[model samples]
Target: MKTTFEFLNQLTKNNNREWFQSNRAKYEDSYNEMILFADQLIEEMNKHDVIETSVGKKSLFRIYRDVRFSKDKAPYKTHWAGTLRRAGANRRGGYYFKISNEESFAMGGFFGPNAQDLLHFRNQIALDADPLRNVIESNDFKNDFGELLGEKLKTAPKGFDKTHPDIDLLRHKQYIIRHDFTLKQVHDPNFPEIMSEAFRKMRPFLDCMTEMITTDLNGIPLV
Candidate 1:
């Protein structure tokens, strides 16, 4: 199997839509390969008894990049990205798993300036320091991302004041767990074991999110 690192390196070199069009066959081949990789990842998670929404059954992969408003204006992306939505809430909300030339991550909750709920959800994350701390303190996180997090947190974006009323409201709202790691690092043989350990440590938070979503949806709980 080609590691994500190899795929990403090739992707970065030809990120333009025209290049993608000319190399359409290669793109299709890579897309099919990534679908298989995602399935393998799901199978690995299942072996560890981790419960995740069904993504493998359907071809959830997407090669297009929606850039109608963005300044960069790249209509297509060379990298493949995909998301595994929760069973019924594909449009409204669900976990997002993305891979790109730069990095790969599993981000739950919402994002974008217009995604009010997601932004609210992100704010809620700041309320409890433990979860965030747990992610930051993990050996994998420390070894790979300690410097990046330290720099970003030290100079957080404007209007994220801890004392603000919006911030307070977020503190009370239900928070979702999101974790990201660089694709290059994850492709390492030792990385799967590290990621599995991290996931196990974060299972309680994941369970909490599943429970909260179930209660909110009036649906059966995952646990």
Candidate 2:
């Protein structure tokens, strides 16, 4: 794990193709270490939520960076990332892990839902804010993850009044809970357990969003 962190720390400084190809062995070693961790994490996650082994593979993000649309043309990413999504659920939401020498975090929620899904998410909030609020406000959830973090509309979202009690919640474009960790913490043998507990505590939040996005009430998806 420490070696992995060293590789990424150096990669952050030298992100070009020539340097990367020269150090391909190091990258491969680091990537394999990450994959092993992901595999273990998937197993732990399955104990709480049904996640396919294939999801572990799908979860491990590619290290290459798509430089076509970006101003920064670095050929590779400085950090490794993975996601664990529900086995049969749509890809709109999942638990994500990103680690670098400098920083790392565990996070999950609905990110970039389509217009219809986003609308339904808001509608879900309007209809039953208690479930969502209760999860976010619980001491365990609050202590682990400070607040629900995401982009918000400057004003109220359409069909939602500004004065609504849960206006701030409805204005969100994404709903996520995140907890940052240091390199020291990630290097600990208990890191996987730490991550599992974090995800376990967040079960309600994941369930709330998953239900909203996947369930159909009447003809339309609830979220």
- Looking at model 1, which ten-residue stretch has the lowest summed lDDT? 147-156
lDDT of 2 by residue, 78-135 (tens): 8988888766654246788888876889998876777888998888788778878888
Per-candidate count of clashing residue pairs (backbone under 3 Å) = 1, 0
Give the per-residue lDDT digits (tens) of candidate 1, residues 5-66: 46456667767767767867766666676767666555555554443555553525565777
Task: Please tell me which predicted candidate would have the highest TM-score against the true structure.
Answer: 2
lDDT of each: 0.49, 0.82
What TM-score quantifies how close candidate 2 is to the native fold? 0.89
Poorest 10 consecutive residues by lDDT, candidate 2? 214-223
Candidate that would win on lDDT: 2
Regions of model 1 farther than 4 Å from truth: 1-7, 48-59, 85-94, 109-176, 182-184, 189-200, 211-223
> Can you give the TM-score per candidate against the true fold?
0.55, 0.89
At residue 146, give the lDDT of candidate 2. Answer: 93
Q: Each candidate: RMSD to true structure?
A: 7.1, 2.7
